[model samples]
Target: MKSQPSLDTSPKVSDEIRKTTCYMCACRCGINVHMKEGQVAYIEGNRDHPVNQGVLCAKGSAGIMQVNAPSRLRAPLKRVGPRGSGQFKEISWDEALDMAVGLLRPVREENPEKLAFFTGRDQSQSFTSFWAQNFGTPNYAAHGGFCSVNMAAAGIYTMGGAFWEFGQPDWDHTKLFMLFGVAEDHDSNPIKMGIGKIKARGAKVIGVNPIRSGYNAVADDWIGITPGTDGLFILALVHELLKAGKIDLDYLAQYTNAPVLVDAETGLLLRDGDGKQLVVDRVTGALTAFDQKGVRPDLRGTHSDGALTHRSVFQHMIERYLDPEYAPEAVSEKTGISAGKIRAIAAELARVAFEEAFELDQPWTDFRGERHEKMVGRPVSFHSMRGISAHSNGFQTCRALHILQILLGTVEVPGGFRFKPPYPKPSEIHPKPHCKVTPGAPLDGPHLGFVHGPEDLALKDDGSPARIDKAFTWENPMSAHGLMHMVISNAHAGDPYKIDTLFMYMANMSWNSSMNTSGVIDMLTDTDDSGNYVIPNIIYSDAYSSEMVAYADLVLPDTTYLERHDCISLLDRPICEADAAADAIRWPVIEPDRDVRGFQSVLCDLGARLNLPGFVNEDGSQKYDDYADYIVNHIRKPGIGPLAGFRGNGNKAGRGDVNPDQLDRYIQNGGFFVEHIPAGANYYKPWNMDYQNWAVGMGLYDSPQPYLFQLYVEPMRKFQRAAEGHGDRQPPNHLRARIKLTLDPLPIWYPPFEDSHV
Candidate 1:
C-alpha cells in the first residue's frame, strides 16, 4: 500500500487515509479520515460503501468535533472529593481499574442482583452485553429503556424480532414515501441515498410531522400534524385504507399474523388448517397468500398455552381497536389538523401507491388491484424516533405508525418497511472472537433466561408471566417492557434482591431520558448507613462530568472512534447488504493519544481480572487481546461458528466474492444480501377474531387497546380477557395501563432523570 499524501495542512489537512465507522447516530456511515501526520484534517463518506454511497449526514460530518472536543477526558480520573463534586485527580489505568473493582466487587458480592449496568446507545451487541452478564447482575438497562424500546417492542410483537436499520424506502419503485417525524438534518446514508434516488425518479414524498424538517422541505407534500397526535393522523390513514378497500389482505394472510386471531390460552393462531378462524379478514382487498405457511407457523404456541393456531395480523387490530371519532371531515377536532388536508393527504397517498404499482408492472396485492401497496402504487415507508416516541403515549404512537405501514402494504418489501442489522441474519460485521450470542439473534431478555433461548412469557400456574425461565424461550416472542416492573422494583427495593452498584458507560440518563428524571437519580443515589445509595459505586466511562458522570465514584476515560478499533454493524447498512459485493474496512484511524481503551478492551481486561474462562486464549493471556484480532477470528477464520467463512473486513462496498485471509478485501467490497426484487403479489392478512392473551403478574385490565412496547403479547391478551370477565368496563384505555409503581404498565413521558442546570 502506498502512503496517500496529505491534502492540506491549514488546520484541515490530512495525509493518512483512515477508514472507520461513524458513531454519530444509529446510521453507521462508513467514514474516511484524511489525516495530516496524525491529526484528522478532513473527513468524508467512503464513496465505495454501498449503504451510504459517498453521502454523509450532518452528524457524521461533525465527527471531528466529537473526537477532538476539548472536553474529552484524556486519562483515568479518581474522584478526589465527594461523589458528584466534579473534582478528580488523574491516575494510571491500574489505579482506576482497582478503584472500580474495589467499589463494585463488594457490591456484587453482597447482592449481585443490585449491581445494574446501564449502557448508552453506542456499539452494542453480544460483546457489549457480555460484560453485564458475566458480572451476574440481573438488572441491565440501556438507552432503549428510554430511547427506542417501545418501537422495538412493537416490532417484536408484530414481527419475530426488531431491526434498527429501518431499511431504505423503495424509492426506485415507490410512488409516495411518507416522512413521519424523521428530521433528515440528522440522517443516515441509506436514507439520504434513498431519498435522492426517489427525488431523482420524481416520486412523491409526504412529510407528516409538527415541524418542517429538511427532508420535509423536499417532500412532495408536507402536513404539520400536532405533536403527540401522530397516532390519530395515522389511524385516519388506516381508516382511509379500509374505507377504500385498498389494503393488501392477501399479503397479510401469507406473511404476517395480521389475518390470524390468536387463542387467548395458547397464543396460537386462531385459525384452523385452512386459515379460517374466529378472526376474519375485513379488508376485502388483495388476497395473495404468498408465504402464509411460513408466516402462521412462527405464530403457533406463543400464547398462554403451548399450541399452534392461525390469526390474521390485521383482523386482530380491528377486533381490539375502535375507530376514533375523528372522521376525515373531523380529523382536525382530534388531531387539530384540517379534515380537508387529511382527505387530500390520504387521497394522495393512495393515488401514489396505486400509480407506482403499475409503473413497476406490479399488481396491487389486494383483490381490487389498486396501487395502494407502494408509494405510487408500490410500497410505503415511515419512521418514528425520539421526537415522536418520547411522548406519554409514545409507544402507542409507534404502534399506530407500524400499523399504518402494514396497511399500506409497505413492510418487508423494496420501498417498504424493512428491518435490517441486529435483526436479520448474516450480520455485516462478524461477531467478536469472544462474542457469545449469534448475529441477529432475537432474545426475550426478561421473558427468556438468556438470548437465543425459547420464549416463556406465557402464564404460570398463577396466571401471570411465568416465573420460571422455562416459560421464556426463543420460541415465544414477548415484551421486554413486561419485565420493566422488575427493574423498577429492584431499583426501589434493597433486601431479598437489590442492585447495590451501578456501572454507566457513555450514558447520560438525566440529559436525554423522558421518565421522571429526579426519581431515577434518587434510585441511582440510593444508599444505606454508609452513605452508599442503591448504586453506591457509580463507575462511568466518559470524558466529562456530564450529569451522570457528576455522580460517579470513579470516572474512566475511553478511546473515541478515531482512536480505537471498533466494529460497525448495528448502525451500518444491513448485514445482508454489507455482504453484498463490497464491505467497509475496520481499522484504527488515529493512534490513541492516551492509554484510554475501547469498551470491549476494558471488559476483556476486566473479564481476565475476574478469571473468566473465555476471556483468555490458548496462550493464557486474553485470546482476543485486541479488536483487530477479534475481527480476524470472526470474519476470517472458517468454521468457527455461525460466522464461519465470514468475509467482511477492510474497506470496500457492495457484495463481492468472499475472501479467506483478505478480510479487509472482503470488507472493502460491499457486503452480502439476498438480491431482492419485486416478489410478485405477496399478501398479509389481519387477525379477525376477538381474542386476548393473559398477562400474568401484570394488573392488565381490558381496554380499547393495550399493547406493550416490548415482548409479552399472550400475557397482555390474558389481562384483556380477565378485565372483560370482571365486568370492569376494561378501565378507560387511558387508565388501564396506569400504575403507581416505579414501572408503569404503559409509557408515561416525563422529564429526564438528571438535568444540567447550568
Candidate 2:
C-alpha cells in the first residue's frame, strides 16, 4: 500500500451553543452544546446552567452516542415491505408531512375522539394540549398508563395533586434520618445533595430496604422489611405511637378532620340537635357516633352548617378496629414479620421522637440533618414508589399507607409528609390575570378528581372548553372496565366520539402499558377507509421503533438530548411561605443536537397551520415561534418566570446561571412563580372545607346525609363486610377480598411482579 499523506488526527473545536432542556427524565435539566465542524467532538456539562450544575450522569454522558446512533433515521422513510418489518424508502419531509396531513385531515372531520395519541416522556416543550384539542380528541393518553398513573391516583385520594420531590426534609434539624427506598448515593445528583447534606450534618441514618444498598453503608441501622410490607410496618409504628402517647396533640387537633361521623340514611355528615357536627372521640380518636351503650345509632346528626357528615362511619371503624385491641400483633401476623421485631422498631422510633421533641425543642436531625430518625422517633413520614405498589391489590396497600400517615400525624409538616403543590402556570387569557389568584382556597374535597387542579379544564386549540363534561369527568360511567369500553364502542358504532387522526409524541406503548400489547397494536392498525383508525391518520414523534410505531403512517424525526434547546423549569424551590425564604437554583450542563427540533416547535407549527387559538403574542397577535424560542421566551418572558430568575443571582434578565441577584431581577421583571399568584385583598374565596362542604358550596345540594367524599367507595372492605353480614353468596369479583387488613377485613398478599427479586 502507498504511504498515506500526513493528516491531522486531533478533533477540531467549533463555536455552537444551542440551549435546550433534557426530556430524557423528569429532572428537566438544561444544557448548552458545543459542536465542531458539524460533528460531535466532545461533551461538557454546562456549568453556567442552573439545574444540573456542572454534573452529568451516565445517561447524560452518552448524549453524543444517542444523537449519532446508527439506528437513528436521518430522513423520513416509507414502509415498502411490510408494517413493523423495518423495510423502508427514505422520503423528504415535504412528502411525509403532506401524506400525513392528507390521511389525517379527513378522518379528523369524521370522528375525532376514537383517535388515541399515546405519548411517553411528554416532557416536550410543546403546547401538547393545543394539538389534542385542535384534533378534538378526548383520548390523548400518555405513558402514564404504565408508569405514574397509579402514583398520581394515590396523590389524588390524599393531596389532590401529583407528588413531586419538592418538599425538602429538614435534614439540618433532624437527628435521625430514616431513608426509605431512596438509597442516597444511588439516586440522581439533586437528590444525592439532600441525602449528602443530611449525612454531613451528623444525623443518624437508618436505611430501610429489602436488600442492602449503597446507602446502607451510611446507616446506623438497616430495617430489612419484606418488599411491599413497608406500609404495614409504618402503620404498626403509628399504633405504637398512640399507645406511648408521643403525638403532637395540638397539631393533630388543629389540622386533622379526624373527628366526624355521618348519618346512614342521609349520606351526609351527621350533626347534633344544636346543629353542631358530631366530633370524633378524642379518647379513641374515632368518630363519636356510638351511643353510651356502645350501640351504633342508625341516624347520625347533621353538622353545624347542616351539611352531611361521615364522622360516625370512620369513628365506628377505628373503635371497632385499629385501636390497641387490634394491635401490632395482628399486623405482624398479616405482614409475615414477628411481633417482637415490630415492637422493637416502634420503640426505637418512639425514643427518637421523644428526644427530638421534648429535649431539643426542635425537630431531631440525622448526622447531616434529616429528622427521618428511626431511633426513638415520633412519626416520620414514609413514602413508597411503584416498587412498593403496582400489584393486584395495589389500591388496598396504598389505602393502608395513607391511613398510617394520617394516624402518625405526618401529613403537612416539615420532616413529615405534606400535601405540596405541582405548580401550574397562570392563564394568560383571563382579564384580571388568572395567575394572580390567591395562594389557596382551603377546599374540602377535590375540585377535579385525579388530575392536577390547574389542568382541570381541558383546553381546545383556542384554549377554550372542549367537551366540558366529558373532559373533566375522571369517572366515566364505564371507566371501571378500563379502555375496553372504548374498544368495544369503536368495534361497533366506531367510538362514540369518533376519532379520525392520531398523533403520538415520544411514546412506545408496546412494552409499557399493562393491557395486552397485541390488542393495542391491532387497534392502532384498525383504521378507517381514509387510512384512519377508528382514527384516520397516525403520526408519531419518537426516537425508536416499538409496537406503537408499527401503526404510524408518518414518523416525525425527534431530536436527541444533545440536539435540542434546554430549559430549566422544574428545579426545587420554596414550597410554602415559610420555606420561601430559602433560595436554590439548578441549571443545565449540556445542549441537544442541532438536527432535531423540540416538540414545542412542532406544536407551534401545527397551531399556526390550524389557526386554532390561545398561544398568541402579547400584542394580541399570533406570530408563534419555534419550540426553542417558545421555551427561551417563556423562561425569560415577563410575569411568566417566577419571583426568582433562572439564575439564583437575582438578575431577572440573566439567561445563564441562576443566583440571588438574578432572582431579584426576575421578580422585578414580572417573572413567573411556582406558587399561585395571589389575587387582590378579599380574593381568598373558600371553596370547600371538605366533600360535604364542597357539595353545598358548589351548589350540588342534597338533603343533609352521611356523605362519602369519594363519589363511589369500592374498597374490598365494603364488599367483604357485606358478605360476612349476608349469606355465603360470594361477593362480586371486583369486590372479592384480596389484601387482608386488621383495620378492615380479609388479609391477602400477592408476590411482587418482578421477574427477578433482585
Candidate 3:
C-alpha cells in the first residue's frame, strides 16, 4: 500500500552522508541520509547494517516528505476552545509540563486506575512500562494486544519459540516451505529476502491461504481453505501421519515430554515422590526417571503407578486425533478442500518430513552425554502471522501449527524452523503481572506480564476489572500483552472504573487507527451533567498533525524521527537474528527547526516535573539532563541498560559497566552493534551448552539449564482445573465453560465461535 519514492527531477547531490536508523515504518532499517549543504538530499539503506542490508522499503525511503510536511505541529498547544474543535494556542514547554503534572498528580495520589496509558505501535515500551509502574498505574500497554498477541502467546506457551520475530524458518537451506495465511507483512524485509534466496535455489514453496495475492502468488502450490479452518487442516495431516506411523518417535522422546506419564482421573502429569515426572521403561516394565540414563521409553501405551490409572501424554494425544472423524474426507466440507487433494498434501508432508531429510557434518554433544558428528534435519519449514491471529480461535490454531512442526522434528534444527536469539526463554518463564497499586509507591512489578492463574488476574476483591483494559480478566485470561483496543470503550462506559485522563503517544485514535470513527469522535468530545468532559483530560504526542490532533485537550508536539535520539533495545523488539544478538540507536542526524522534543525526552521531563521515584536524585534534582543522558545512564538492574554492546571501559559487549561515551561508540560502529555468537552455538539452542552459557552471560536469558520444548503446556491445565472448581482460585460461573474448553493443554481444533452456528 506504499507509494514508491518519486524520481527527483534535479540531479541528486550530496555534501556529506550521515548514518542513522529509519522510522518511516516499523522495520527500523539503517539508512545513510545524504545532506546537501544543510538539507536532506536523499536517503538510502546502510549496506553493512544487519536489518535491511543495502535495501530500503518504499515507506522508509519516503521519509523526506514526513520531515518536511507543512501540517506538522511546531510547538505545544493547550486547547483554547471546545475539544475536537481543532482549536489550539501555542505554549512553551514549561507551561505544558506544569499542566501535565497538575492533571496526573491527583490521579496518582488517589487512584492510579483513573489514568490509561496506551500507544499505537510504540517501539519504546521499556521506558513506557517503567514510567507507568513508577507512576503507580496498572493500565499500560503497547498495541500488541489487539494486533498479534495471540500468535505470540500460543507459540511461546507451546514451544518456547514463535514463528515470527522470535523464530523463523532456515530459509537458506530449506527444500520445501509452507506458509499458512501470511501476507506481505510481519518482518517484511527479512521474509522477502528469505523467499528470494529460496526461489533462487529451486526450492518448492506452498501457501495455505484464503487469498492468493502477494507472497501466495509466488507459491508453487496454493491451497485455498476456509477462514479459521487452518487448525482442522493441520490436525487432519497429523491424523494421516499417525495412521501411517510416520512420526519421529526418537526426536519426540529425546526433546519433548512425549514419554511423560499423565493421570486420567486428575488429567495431570504423574510424578514420583521427588516430583520428577515419570515415564514407563519398555525394557523393565516399571516406572523410571524421565531423564534416566539408559532407559528406552514406550511412546504408545497405557500404564499406572498404582495410585491411579494413567497413560503417557503421547498416548492421550493420539487418542484425541486418531479418531475416524479426523480423516481428510470428514473435514473436507468444512475446509473447502476435497478429500483427494487433502490426502495428496498430507502424503507430501509425510514424505518431505521423513524421506527428504538432510544432514550436517557438524560435531555437537547433546545433554545426555551422547556424541553426534552430524545434525539430522527435516528440510521443511513453516510461518504464519496476523491472518491466523486475528480470529477468535487464533490461539488454538497457532498452537496446532507449532504441534505440526514438532511432530516433524523440525524445531531449531538445520533446514527447519529455527528459534531466533534470546528465545527459548524457559517455557514457563513469563512473569506475573503486578496489579496492586499503593499511594506514593510504584506497583510491585510491571503492568504487563503473563498471568499464571486466577490469582494473578488484575481484578478487584469484588471481581471487577482493576485496570481499564480488562486484559487479564476471565474474558481474556491468557492475554500476555494488555489489551489496548478495549481501553477506550471500557473507560468511556466506566465498565470497571472511571478515568481522569487518557495519555497516548504516537497513536492516531481518530481515523483509520480506531473503530467507528464517528463514535470515537463523539466519545472524545462527550460531556457529563456538570458541563465537564466525560474523559476529563486528553494528551497526545505526534510528529505530524494527523486527524488525531483535532481531538487532544493538550497537544505535546514531537520532533520528527531524524531529529531525535531513540534506542531499540534487547528489552523489547530489537533486531536480533537466529545467529546473533544485536541492538541499535538513532542519534539526531539533523537539528530540529521546531520547538519540539522527542517523546522519550518529554516523558522524562514529565517524570521530573512530578518528582516520580526514579526520575529524581536524593537531593530532589533531575537525574538526567535529557533523553540521551538517561539512555546512557539509566540502569534497569545492576549492569544492564538500553544497549548491550560497547559497555564498559571500551572493550566488551553485553553486561559491562556503563561507559560515559556509549552513544559515541554506537555511532562509530555505523549506528548499531551486533554481538558475535560462535558458530557452534547457533543450532539446537535449548540444549546447546555454548549457546546457553553465552545467552545467560549476555543477560539475555536468566538461567543456563537446558530448556525442554513444551509439547504439552501444563499452565493451561491449571487454569482448566481452576475452571472446574478444584483449585485455590476458580473462575466465575459464567466463564467456567469457556475457560474449560479453550485451556486444553494439547492443541485442539474447534470452529471459531461464529462458525459453529453458521
lDDT per residue for candidate 1 within 83-152, as digits (tens), equals 5567888899998877777766665455454455666665544455555555655445455544555565
**Candidate 1 Cα outliers beyond 4 Å, as residue runs:** 1-12, 106-110, 160-164, 261-268, 271-326, 359-379, 419-497, 512-534, 543-545, 570-586, 617-621, 634-715, 722-758
User: In candidate 3, what are the lDDT values of residues 555-584, reduced to their tens digit?
Assistant: 899888888998988878787888889888
User: Highest TM-score, which number?
Assistant: 3
> Which regions of candidate 2 fall more than 4 Å away from where they truly are?
1-23, 30-55, 160-163, 179-187, 206-228, 264-317, 320-326, 358-381, 417-500, 513-537, 545-551, 566-596, 615-623, 632-758
Question: At residue 165, what lDDT does model 1 achieve?
Answer: 48
What is candidate 2's lDDT per residue for 401-509, written digit by digit as tens? Answer: 5554444444444444433222111111111101111111111211122322223333333433332123222122111102321332243245224445556676665
- Candidate 1 matches the true fold with a TM-score of 0.71
Candidate 1 lDDT at 405 equals 66
> Model 1 Cα RMSD, Å?
10.4
TM-score of each: 0.71, 0.64, 0.95
- Among the numbered candidates, top lDDT falls to 3
- Candidate 2 lDDT for residue 612: 37
User: 6 in model 2: Cα distance from truth in Å?
Assistant: 24
- Candidate 1, residue 332: how far the Cα is off, in Å: 2.7
Every model's Cα RMSD, please? 10.4, 11.3, 4.0
The local distance difference test score of each candidate is 0.50, 0.43, 0.83
